[model samples]
Target: MAPVSLGVLASGRGSNLQSIIDACRRGDIKAEVKVVISDRQDAYALKRAEKHGIDAYYINIKDYQDKAAYETKIVELLRRYNVQLVCLAGYMRLVGPTVLNAFPWRIMNIHPSLLPSFPGLHAQKQALDCGVKVSGCTVHFVDEGMDSGPIILQACVPVYDDDTEDSLAERILEQEHKIYPRAVGLFAEGKLIVRGKKVFIREAGND
Candidate 1:
């Protein structure tokens, strides 16, 4: 079967993007990153895409007049690349319904903390502030809400007493790098099923 073609949105270093790219290269995932887009001009994901010979572009939200206009413009870019899957890799922008309505369940995102616990920014700090012993990362299907979507997979990492927010985030980020690619591979292989608010992962023997 042909690999699922991806269009990833990013805003920063794109460590997750590199993971996806590596997964595809190693044949650990049956997917192709077709294009990468970022709102930030200096985003390293663009350079990484260029190094990988993938199409890359930038569309500034500031240049756009409104959020709706910005989202519409992004949707057009995704369409231009024939993107079948949309991955949000550290994209800071809150997407309007224009793109969400366009992709529906086809979009996936990796959130910093276990969702339904900390849904907004500074999630690692939220976990530390709330004094939770357990904190982790989540890969979920993107909905219109802030991190309120059907979860695909979650890997738990314990929080320690001596850990600061930055340290805890670093631990969670390691787990994020592990699972995000797996989640995308599962989706590409037709092994992940979403029913209502629940997610089903097929036993793929450590895939």
Candidate 2:
């Protein structure tokens, strides 16, 4: 079978992007990163993609007249690459309706917190502030809302009494690297089924 082609959008250092790249190279995920797009020119994710000989692009929002135009350009690039899946690795922009309609449930994002709890930025800080005993990461299908998508997988870590935001984030990141790729692998294997707000995993060899 041909491997699933992935297009990653990122704005930061892209540790999650690196994890996906590494997983693909190790055959741990039946997918290949076709291209990477960043909104910032200096993002390290672009460099990571280029180092692996993958196509990388920087699409500045300032270059476009509106958010819709910017996302339309993104959709164009994804289609050009024949990308089968879209992954957001620390991408700082909310996906607009254009891209959402284009890909539907084909988009995936890895959030730093057990979502529906802390959805936006500084998730670790939010968990720490609330004095949550357990904090974790979530891999979910992307929707129009901010991290409000249905969950696919989650890995929990105990929040120590002395844990700072950075400490909790560091531990959660380790699990993020592990499960993000696994979620992608499941998608590649056609095991994900979305029903209403729930995602069901098909049993192996069922199809």
Candidate 3:
């Protein structure tokens, strides 16, 4: 079978993007990153993609008139790559209707906290402030709302009493690296079925 083609959007160092790239290369995930797009020209994610010989693009958000226009251009880029899936790795922008409507449940994102919890930025600090004993990462299908999508896979990390924001985040990031690829792998294998707010991962070859 042909590998699932992925269009990855990122805005920072792209550690999760690196994890996905590594996963694909190791055959741990039945997918290939077709292209990478970043809103910032200096984002390291673009460099990561280029290093791997994948086409990388930098779209200037300031040039677009509105969020819709910005997302429309992104959608155009993704379509050009014939991307089968969209992954957001540390992509700071909230997804707009244009991209959401284009991909539907085909989009995935890795959030730093066990979502429905610390959702937006500084999630680790949010978790630490709330005194939660456990903090983790969630891989979920992207929707119109912010990190409100149905969950696919999650890995928990114990929050130690002495854990600072950086410490908790570091542990959670490790889990994120593990699960994002697994969730994408499930999608590649046709095992992910979304019904309302729930995502069901079916047995391999049984679906």
Candidate 4:
């Protein structure tokens, strides 16, 4: 089967980007990251893509006149690469309607908290402050709202009594690394279904 082609958008160090790349390299997922796009000029995700021989481009949100124009460039990049999926890994910008409409359910994000709980920035700290005994990460479809889409998958991490925000963040991130890739793999493999604002994942076990 031909692998799903992906365009990853990230603004940070690309740890999740690297995780997907490593999964692709090991054949754990039947997909390839076709390109990396960043709004920031100095994002390290570009370097990671270049190292893997994938096309990397920076579409300056500052260069465009409005949000529509900025998203137009993003869509252009996806079309240029014939991308089948888009992944947001720490790509701090809020995606507008243009990009969401273009890809539909094809774009996804990994948020640091079990969404519907702490939905925006500083989610890790929010979880810690709320004193949740169990905190986790969520992978979900991206909509116009921030982290307010239907859930795809989640992996929980226990919040230790002595856990600090940073420490708990690191732990939840490890789970993100696992579930996010699995979510993408399921999508690429035709194993996921979305109906009536809920996702129904087909069980793969031989029960």
Q: Judged by lDDT, which candidate is best?
A: 2
lDDT of 4 by residue, 1-207 (tens): 999999999998899999999998899999999999998889898899899998899888789899899999999989899999999989999998898998998899999988878999999889888999998999998888889888899888999989998999899988888988898899988887777568788878621
| Each prediction's whole-model lDDT (CA) | 0.92, 0.96, 0.95, 0.90
Write one digit per residue (lDDT tens) for candidate 2, span 94-204: 998999999999999999998889999999999999999998999999999999998999999899999998889999999999999999999999999999888999998
TM-score for each candidate, following the candidate numbering:
0.95, 0.98, 0.98, 0.96
Q: Provide the lDDT at 145 for model 2.
A: 96
Best first by TM-score, ranked: 2, 3, 4, 1
Find the 10 residues in a row with the least total lDDT in model 3: 198-207
Q: Write the per-residue lDDT of candidate 3 for residues 1-207, one digit (tens) a residue.
A: 999999999999999999999999999999999999999899999999999999999999899898898999999999999999999999999998899999999999999988889988999999988999998999999998889999999999999999998888888889999999999999999999999999998995676
The order of the candidates by lDDT, greatest first, is 2, 3, 1, 4
Better of 1 and 4 by TM-score: 4
Can you tell me which runs of candidate 3 are displaced by over 4 Å? none
